[model samples]
Target chain A: MFQTRLEETAAQVAAHLTHVLDGYPAHPVTDAMRYAVQGGKRLRAFLVMESAALHGVDPQQAMQAAAAVEALHAYSLVHDDLPCMDDDDLRRGLPTVHVKWDEATGVLVGDALQTLAFELLAAEQTHNNADVRVALVASLARASGAHGMVLGQAQDIAAETAGRPLTLEEITALQANKTGALICWSAEAGAVLGQADPTPLRTYATALGLAFQIADDILDVEGDAAKAGKRLQKDADAGKATFVSLLGLDGAKQRAKTLVLEAEAALSPYGDAAENLREAARFVISREN
Target chain B: MFQTRLEETAAQVAAHLTHVLDGYPAHPVTDAMRYAVQGGKRLRAFLVMESAALHGVDPQQAMQAAAAVEALHAYSLVHDDLPCMDDDDLRRGLPTVHVKWDEATGVLVGDALQTLAFELLAAEQTHNNADVRVALVASLARASGAHGMVLGQAQDIAAETAGRPLTLEEITALQANKTGALICWSAEAGAVLGQADPTPLRTYATALGLAFQIADDILDVEGDAAKAGKRLQKDADAGKATFVSLLGLDGAKQRAKTLVLEAEAALSPYGDAAENLREAARFVISREN
Candidate 1:
């Protein structure tokens, strides 16, 4: 049931994105923008949709917010892959934006995609209430800005230059800010739209986000580069600290499992209706990619 | 009056920025963000404030929008100066963000700053009506995204790589989308806040934006590096087609003057109360640096 629903949500979000990106004047940056946003797992989209559904928010209205998070996620990946940052050549088995085009195009595409995220969220159709739209915009800005993902990026960069690996607590905080911020936003978005208490979803996302990062660390250490669609073991190569390094592989696996349990527990208030969300939490720690 | 008001506006915007930036964790990227945003002429900020004033919006409310535009502008400049882009070492007499910090910091700061711009505008203090805030966010996104400044930037880069100069009409259109989009947004912002018809301010900004770009072109030809505080004449040196290249130096000056006149004329709807805006148009054409 979860798999079918997740796949359905991804398709719907992708179609909506195609519609939104339609009619861009065919320049390389525009082309690159489209290309960069094309393929992501859309886990964020599924989270948004599932959470919104759990809260009785119309999925039609939820799709835009879903697309917005995916777009924002795509922008982060594009920028993260730039030579000045991670310097990866491939994303999802294809050339990264800078690799396919030029560094300039990568920068502009990421910038433009970020702008498009806000644009989508601010559209009136996304929500009937203006306050809701504004809330989405403001919260998203906080989630993605200097205080959020960018801050985490800065911390990661600073850690690299400091000639030392971070402690376990530091890595946890870093990942929480970096990957977890957007995940929290994605999970909480439906409640934001529905004007319900975000506490449960927020709790679910906290554990889910941390579990997701641990899974990535596990994948980096043991997963195939082809499956991951980018370089693997980059943290080890850069002498960076990660859950797999701080906690033993087995220990990391155990911790991720525990997080999944916590995430599942957070959804108990929604009863069996949140079955997909519980499945999602389990999937985070278990997915190879 | 215009000079004092502009200075006052810059100071107020600066102070507000300082407050917004107050609690950021002391880090290189945060420090670089402050440095990069500092010391620009604040022309866009002034425009936002003055236009909001024209609509009788509260100065306190108006300052956030002003700061938002300036933050957005700062982000544009930072990314534009990267090695893959314009690669300038200096900006406003200080080392560019990349030079002062590192390429990673430059990219992150710009990304964060752009996020901060939307965050500031979406703040409840920035407007009373949620719809007004949403309008500001949407308009800004359009102005700054693939359709607007980024499109213009991509065109400029493509023109350089094409190994041929753009025609006069092409450059005009490019500049309109690039500089004019943001300028138009800044000018029309007050009208958006006031819920007034933005026709006249839109017209005023169209001419002002073109005149500003023309002045930039003129400065590229004749302004001193010392006063300009960045490399000058790079356009002429690269054989890039500019207003001065398309029109003779005298013709470029004449064209800028005409634009100033047109810009001033568009302010007639506001009568003598728009004297500062008129002077702004004149200043665009006449300022040396």
Candidate 2:
């Protein structure tokens, strides 16, 4: 049921994003962007909307943040799949943007998507309070800036050039910046929109994010190729470090379970309203891909 | 005298950008960002500061917008010079970002610098009014989004792949979106900060930007390589249609002069207060590089 809710949220976000992109001059960059964002788990959008629901923020008002996170997440995927970065040929069972269009389109699409995310948040439709909107803008910038996602990406690139795999602590730090930061932003956005306390959601997101990545590591070893879409176990093949490599498969699974539990417990303050978030956290490790 | 003022503003912007980047964790992306942002025209910064001055906006309060535009310009250049794009080896008589750093680092640095620009504009220091800050962020997103800068890039890339020269109107539209949009934003930023009508500055920038591009076309034909600090006449060599190619040498020069005059005339409403902007318009055509 929670999975269905996430799918529903994904659809909602997709529709909103389409509306947001309307009226732009049609170009390959826009086409690449559309293709890149077409399908995803929309986990970030789910987190934003669920988090907002728990805070009593109207979904209409929170849609911007929800869409914003998905847009940002999509941009990351587009860029990370570039020939210069991950060099992947497949994403969500479709050809990567660079492969489908061209590297120029890939780069510009990612660039535009990133800005479109910011533009969505900055628009008055997102929040009535200018202060709140600016805060959202500032927080997203921090979450995705050099101190955040970009920094994580650089470290990953550095590790490959260094010809040595990262250690556990380094991987954790790297993943925190790369994936965890955006997840945290999504979870906290609802609280921000409603001006509610963000501590509980922040805590929940930290554990949920770690669990999510651990699941990715586990799936690399165990997931069905057709379901995963992209190549699995590339990290292991490349001799790069990952949670499974660092903790052993069983150990990583165990840690993920503990984190999911912690993540669920963090939602206690919100009581029944946060049931969806708790289920979502549990879904992180349970999903096949 | 105008050259000296431009240098002074460049220094001021560089210092402010440095201060803004102070606490970011030291990494290759950060290093590349510093390297990429160092030593540029800083013409956009001058426009922001001079326009702010015309509106009696405090230079202190205006510094962030000035710095923000430069950071953004640096990002655009870094990405634009990537192997998939313009693929320049030299910029400012030094290695381009992808040449100086790896391609991955080049992409990350450009990505980070862009968000850093938004972060600076969203900061309270840019404007005391939350409304004003949000407006700045929104304007920037629009200026840099698909409808503006990225659309121009797509058109240019499309032209290259199309294997034919663009029509005069098409080149004009492409250049307007490419260089003109950001320049227009830079010229209008100060007015946005002061909450004043941006019509005069907008008009001034429209002509100045076209004239600026025309002059660049001229420089590519006649300027010394060492002075220009990058490959000149590459567009012509590539069989690209440019302002100079569309119009003859003398015709292009005559056009730039006419645009400069129009730019200066648009600044007349500010009287003596707009002298710097008028001078800037003249400088756009007169500079050798």
Candidate 3:
């Protein structure tokens, strides 16, 4: 049931992105933007839809925010894959935007994609309450900007040049900002829309985000390259410290499982309405990818 | 009077940006972001402030939006100067961000600055009314994203690879999107905040924007590099068609002067209250850089 619902949310998000993107003028940047956003797992979108359902917010309304998060995530990936950054050629089983198109297109497409995320949140169709729309934009900007995801990325880059391995605690902090911030925002979005206190969802998302990162670290070490749909073991190749490197593989696995349990417990306030989110937490650690 | 007011607006906007950016956690990316936004003409900021004042909006309330446009413009400049893009080495008489730091820092700084722009507009302090704040975000997104500034940039790139000079009409349309959209947005912002129709300012801005670009083209043809604070004549060297190239130097100057008149005439609705804006229109074509 969880798998079915997740896939459904993913499809809806993809369709919404296509429909929204279609309204823009045709340009190569637009094409590159479309290409870059095409194939993410849509876990963020799933979190958004499921959380909104739990809050009784209309799925269509939630879809706007869902697509916005996915768009923002896609922008980050496209930029991180640039030759000057991660320099990856493959992503989601396809050529990176910089590889398929040119670097300029890659840069512009990523930029335009980021702008599109805020555009989606600010539109009237996203929410009838202008206050909710502004809140969404503000929260997203905080999560993705200098204070959050970008800070993590800069720390990662700084760590690379420091000529020393990151400590376990340092890696955890870095990962929390790099990937966990957006994930937490996704889980808390429905509450923002519903005008409810988001403390519990925030707690739920915090654990879930950490578990998801630990799982990613585990995947880098042990997961199949084809199934993961991109290059694998990059952290080890770069001699970077990861959860699986700082902790033993078994230790990392244990930690992720514990985090999942915490995530499940945090959702207890919602009971069955949040069962899907609980399943999502479990899926984060166990998925092959 | 216009020059003094423009400089005054520049100082205030810079100070506001500094105060806001200082609140973010310290990091290398934050350093790069601050460096990137340090200096510019601040014409867009002036437009936002001047238009807001015309609408009787409080200056402090308008400062947030003013700072936001400058941040967005700075981000565009940083990205445009990337090695993979225009490959510029100097801007505002200082080394470009990538030249001062590295390409990775350049990319991240630009991304974060763009996020900061939307964050400023979405802040509660920008306005007491949520609808106005959302309107600002939505309009800015439209101006800067795939449909507006990015569209113009993509078109410019396409023209380069197509091995043909753009016609006069094509260049005008392209410029309308490139430098024009944000300027128009800045001009209309006060009206948006004031809950007044923006048609007059839009007309004024459209004419003002074209004249500004024509002045840029004229400067590219025959302006002191020291005064311009950057390289000039690269457009002619690259054989790219510009206003000065398409319509001779004399013709371009005449067209810019004519557009200044149109821009001034658009402000007739406001009488003496709009004299500063009228002066701004004249300054657009007359400034050295």
Candidate 4:
């Protein structure tokens, strides 16, 4: 039941994002922009909407935040796939943006998408309070920019040639910055936009984000490449660190369970206000890719 | 006199930026972060300060805007210098960030700097109104993101392999997006923060931005690489379109004068309120490097 709702929210957010992005100028850059944004699972968007729903925020308000988060996620993926970065040729069973439109366009499209995320939030109808809008913008900027995901990417790259396997704690730190920060921010942003207090929401999102990463690590190790729709075991091949690398497979699985339990516990204070979020935490750990 | 003021503002803003960036975690990534922010002509910052001065805004407020603009500018430069993009090795008489810190750190630092720009704006205490803060954030986002500098970079890369020489108009469009947009936005942002009417300020910034590019083209043709602190005549070697490439050096100079005149005219209604800006326009066209 939760899967159906997640899928619906993801689809709606993706469609809205496509419509908004289509309004850019019809140049070669636009072609790359389209390519970067067109194919994403919209998982982050789902998190935002689900978390907002758990807080009893209007779905429409949640959708706006979802769209912005999705745009940011799309932009990061585009840049991450560039030759100078991950050098990936494929993403989600399609040619990566850099492959389709050249590296420069890929870069620009990613940049534009980042800007578009802010633009969506700044629109008059997103929130009536200007302070709330500023807060949302600040939150998104921190998650998406250098101190957040960008720093994560930098650490990941530095890890490649550092001549030692990263500790589990270090790996967690990396994932927290790279994969977890935005996800955490997405949930908190939805709550903030919904007029919920951000302090507890942030704590909940952080734990949830780590759980999400643990699940991702497990899937990358165990899931089918075609099913995953992107390269798998690249982490192992690269000798990069992950939760699964530090903990044995069984140990990692056990840790993931613990993390999910902790995440659910973090949501407990919200009481009935967080039922969906609790369910989503369970879904995050148990689902197969 | 203008050069002295530009140098002083650049130094002051750089110092402020350095102080703020130093607070980050001390890591390899942080080193790259410092490298990206440490030095520049701070032309954008200068424009911001000068424009603010014209409007009777506190110079300190202008300094914050200048620092933010410089951060954005530095981030773009780092990303642009990556191997997948322009692939330049030298910047500001030092190795490019990618060359100094590896491609990943370079990318991350750029991302971090971009985020830091918004953060600085958000954290600024001077702008008491949330609406003004939102507008500043929105304007900077537009100038730096997909529709602005990023698009310009994309166009620049596309033009390289476009298999055709671009027309004068195409070059101008490229320059406007790549170089002019952020510079124009910097000036306009200062005015906005100063509570100056933004319409005329934007117009003035736009014309000045183009003139700045025209001057850059002329400099690339005649300036020494050592003095310019970046590669010279590489534009010609790459066959990248520019004002001087489309028009002869003399014609480019003439076009620059025309632009400066137009830029000056845009600020004329402000009378002496805009004298520094008018002088800056002339300085842009007449500077040696």
Best of the candidates, lDDT: 3
- Our model 4 lands, by Cα RMSD against the true structure, at 2.0
**Residue clash pairs of candidate 2:** none
Which 10 consecutive positions of candidate 4 chain B have the poorest summed lDDT? B120-129
Candidate 3 interface RMSD, angstroms, 1 decimal:
0.5
Badly placed stretches (over 4 Å) of model 1 are: none
Query: Positional deviation of B100 in candidate 4, in angstroms?
Result: 1.6
Candidate 3: tens digits of C-alpha lDDT, residues A1-289: 9999989988899899989999999887887888888886899999999888888898899999999999999999999999999999999999999999999999999999999999999998889999999999999999999999999989998998888999999998998899999999999999998888899999999999999999999999999999998999999999998898889999999999999999999988898889899999999998987
Best by TM-score: 3
- TM-score of predicted chain A against the true chain A, for each candidate: 0.98, 0.98, 0.99, 0.94
Per-residue CA lDDT of candidate 1, range A1-289, in tens?
Answer: 9889888987898888878888667777877877887776799999999989988998888999998999899999999999999898999989999989989999999999999999999998799999999999999999988888999888887788777789999999889889999999999999999999999999999999999999999999999988788889889888888999899999999999999999999999999999999999998877767
- Residue pairs with clashing backbones, model 4: A112-B146, A146-B111, A146-B112
Q: How would the candidate models be sorted by TM-score, starting from the highest?
A: 3, 1, 2, 4
- Per residue, candidate 4 scores C-alpha lDDT tens digits across A31-144 of 666666666557688778877776677777677778888888888888898887899998988889878767767766776777778877776667778787888888888776
What's the CA RMSD of model 3 in angstroms?
Answer: 0.7
Better of 2 and 4 by lDDT: 2
The DockQ-based CAPRI class assigned to model 2 is: high
Q: Which consecutive 10 residues in model 3 chain B have the weakest lDDT in total?
A: B154-163
Predictions ranked by lDDT, top down?
3, 1, 2, 4
List model 2 lDDT by residue over B138-185, tens digit each. 988888889888888888878976877888899889989988989999
Best-fitting candidate, measured by DockQ? 3
lDDT of 1 by residue, B99-195 (tens): 9888988989999999989999999999999999999999999999999999999999888978789999999999998899999999998889888
